[model samples]
Target: MTGPHALKPFLLAFPGPLRDRLVAAVLSGEKTATTGLLLEYEAEKEELPEVGERSALIDSDGREVAVVEITEVQVLPLRDADLRLALAEGEGYRSVAEWRAGHENFWHGEEMREALGDPGFVVDGDTMLVVEWFRVVEVLREA
Candidate 1:
C-alpha cells in the first residue's frame, strides 16, 4: 500500500469500530468532516494536512477506501466547537454538549491517555483541535 504508484494514504480518523462506521458514513455521503489533535499528534508528527490536500482514506487494516479533498481547515479550541461543527462531523449529534461529551470520552480513553502519557488528560476550552472539512472526490472500489 506504500509505493510511488500506489494511492496516497491518510488515516481512517479513528480506530476499530468507530473508524469503520465513520468510513462507511463518509462513503454514504453522511459524513463530510473530521477532527484530530492539532498539537500532540499533527504538529508532533510534522504532518499537519492543509486545506485543499487530497488523501486516500484508509481503513484500520491500512487498505485504501476512498479519496477525499480537504475543503476547509479550522484550528480551534474544543470549547469553540459549536453545533455547526458537530453537524459537519456527520455523527448526528444534536448539540454541542452531546458532541463534547462524546469527544471528551474518546480523548480520555485508556489508549489516548497512555499514548499521551497523561492519565489526567482532559478536553477543555483551550484544547486545540484540527477540524477538517472534506468532500469525497472518489471512492476506491475494492478489486
Candidate 2:
C-alpha cells in the first residue's frame, strides 16, 4: 500500500476559470471531491485514479499548487449524482439543481466541444463519470 509520502506525483490540470475556482476550493479545504467524464478518460486513454493516489494539483499556468490524495473513487451515471456529493464539490452549490446546471453547461459548452473536437457531444442521464473524493495532503507554497 502506498501512502501520500510514498506515491509518485500525477498531474491534475485545472485549465480555466471554473476549474481554477474548484482548485482554490480544494486548496482551502472547502472542496473534497470532483467528477470527471468517463468518456474523457477513455478518449485520453488515461487510467482511472485509484484510492490512495496522490497528484500535483496544477493551475492554468502549469504550476503545481498542492498535492492531493484520493480517498475514494466511485463510478456512476451523471444522473445518479446526489446533493450530498454535489455539495462536496464546493463552489457554494447549495442545491443539486445548481450543481447539475453548472456542470451540464460546462460539459456541453462550446469550449469543451472545441477542445475535445466533438461538436455534437451531449451529457445525458446515462453519461458515466468517475467520482472522486480526495483531500489536500500538502499545499506547495512554492513550486
Give the Å error, residue 76, model 2: 0.4
- Which lDDT value does model 1 have at 100? 85
lDDT of 2 at 29: 87
48 in model 1: Cα distance from truth in Å? 2.0
Encode model 2's per-residue lDDT on 1-143: one tens digit a residue.
Answer: 14645444444333777667777788888888888789888888889999998887776666678889999999999889999888998878898889888788888988777766899999988999898899988898633
Q: Write the per-residue lDDT of candidate 1 for residues 81-108, one digit (tens) a residue.
A: 9888888777889999998887888888
Report the CA-based lDDT of candidate 2 relative to the real structure: 0.80
**TM-score of predicted model 1?**
0.88
Runs in model 1 deviating more than 4 A are: 5-8
TM-score list, all predictions? 0.88, 0.87
Lowest summed lDDT across 10 adjacent residues in model 2 is found at 5-14
